[model samples]
Target: MKRWYVWLGAAVSLVFLYFALRGLQLQQVWAGVRTANYWWLVPGVAVYFLAVWARTWRWHYLLRPVQRVSLRNLFPILVIGYMGNNVYPARAGEVIRAYVLKRRERVDMSPSLATIVVERIFDGVVMLFFVFVALPFTPLPEWMRRTVVLSSALFFGLLLAFFILAASPRQARAVYVWAVGRFVPEAWRPRVTAVLDRFMDGLGCLRSGRDVAMVFVTSVAIWLTETVKYWFVMHGFGFSVPFYVLMLMAAVVNLATTLPSSPGYVGTFDGPGIAILAAFGVQAALAASYTLVLHAALWFPITALGVYYMWHERVSWSDFGAAERARRSEPEVVGTEMRDARQREVR
Candidate 1:
């Protein structure tokens, strides 16, 4: 990650932290944190991992057109990816997961990365669905309403583009060929085309309406599973919000995390979470404590598991940097070499 980008993310976190903590209730917040019932978190954590497993299944489904990796093999990789997201800036865990998949499964990084992108777009769409579902029950602030509008535009726009590309690869390729011919240097054209071709392979699942429907259904299932964790955590803190409101909280907080923030989504996650609950009549201090605990619950277990998996897979910390760098500047050799490997595996 660029130094300035990292610094900028940290700055955004600080600004959000200011909003999340700008009141006079430290004692009450501590009291809420100290007095909360801890037993409820057991079920919450269990349910959270269930969501993770569902995520593994979803990824497995998405990759069917590219490679039919098993759920057992994909689980650890998914955890490690989430772990990367928690610790690294710019969600670099995504690229790390792609790197790991390449190492273990011989999938080309470009196509695998493309699948990951599809996963994110679907996730965004689900989050928007949750937001809209809760909208009638929960009145969002003006700023939040605007945020939802912008997010809807962004997610739907990407979905259409991907659908078009996947559904009409020849047309997409024609455009790509024209662009490459016009803009790419003669020496680089073949390599660029090869990389793009693999990427389109990743989008293969989107080409079928049945497959697209399956993905959407699974995406909804994944988020709903996670929202169960949110509900469980809310009980631990002795706060009461309707299930749909919890859905709203889950939606807004996640959508907020998409903004630039420090690793683990420090401020971006907490600020919106606290704000949402408080808006719904929970005490600010109580909301703050719950959000903090929920954040830790969401972060620590998976991250520790990711570390263990990293060790088990013999992947080092340096690999994270390598993955990020790989995304930025893939070796031209990858264009020719990985493409042939992919073709052989497909055949």
Candidate 2:
């Protein structure tokens, strides 16, 4: 049922994107594309690759205390995961990633997934920080202030929830069990409870001050690199946007991806990118052009590289789909239990 909903949502998003693009004038878009400094795109692409490498390092670093995996082993998997996100909806790339690491590094999927969840929290907090810092510098409209305020409040609320859960495993476990008990069959309750118990164990990595500091630093660096990439793309298009404005734009673009959308964030990402740029005083046509170019800069190369790596790893789209299916079929307890076990081991 969940998988069906994801596919249905993805289909609708894709149809919307197709129509959105069709509505735009081909000549105008071509003119924008033609104006692009193709050479500048090269460096933009390199910066994007570097950003991915940094992100993979951060992910590997977070997993280090529990399981020591080399960056070399993780980077390709990370790229493949991002590729999955572009092609699949509901961000199944995350589960695909946990599955890959589980297969390649003997890492249990649940704990690994817990770390990913933690990483996402860090990413959100950092992005929100950037948005807050950059807010005054950008020429945000009065109407948009409410949107920013609402988003920031929600983001911090989530962060607070993560911190509370991380600090109190028993409480989290109780909540998890309660939620599971509401729907899971009585016959399977014991097994489900055992699985969730292990999953809660994975949250223990946050107990270390050193680990927390390292993860925070890495999260900042990753987002900063992303900001630089966004700036570079704008520069490539001869736009004179400030660094902080680009940072806010980057935050907006990241937030946009969190929305339900088609493969590669098609209309969803582009629309937000253009709107954010326009908020910063960029012209509509140029903003649209810049958004498309930036989208290509970030999405196209990694996707192509992901395909190559997937082939090299001998994993087909069907294989990935099957793995996703397998993951979905597992009782949530399986993941929760494994995570709890890993957290206990880490602590």
Backbone clashes in model 1, listed as residue pairs: none
Q: Give stretches of model 1 more than 4 Å off.
A: 329-331, 338-347
| Candidate models: Cα lDDT each | 0.91, 0.77
Model 1 accuracy (lDDT, Cα): 0.91
Instruction: Report the C-alpha lDDT of model 2 over 144-203, residue by residue, as the tens digit.
Output: 677778777877787677677778878888888897799888767766676555455556
Tens-place lDDT digits, model 1, residues 1-347: 88998998999999999999998388998899899998889999999999899899989998999999999999999999999999987898999999999889988888999999999999999999999999998778888889899999999999999999998999999999899999999888878887898899999999899999998999999899889998988898887989998889889899888888899999999998999998999999999999999999999999999999999999999999888777656647666686688899999
The parts of candidate 2 lying over 4 Å away from their true place are 1-26, 174-183, 332-347
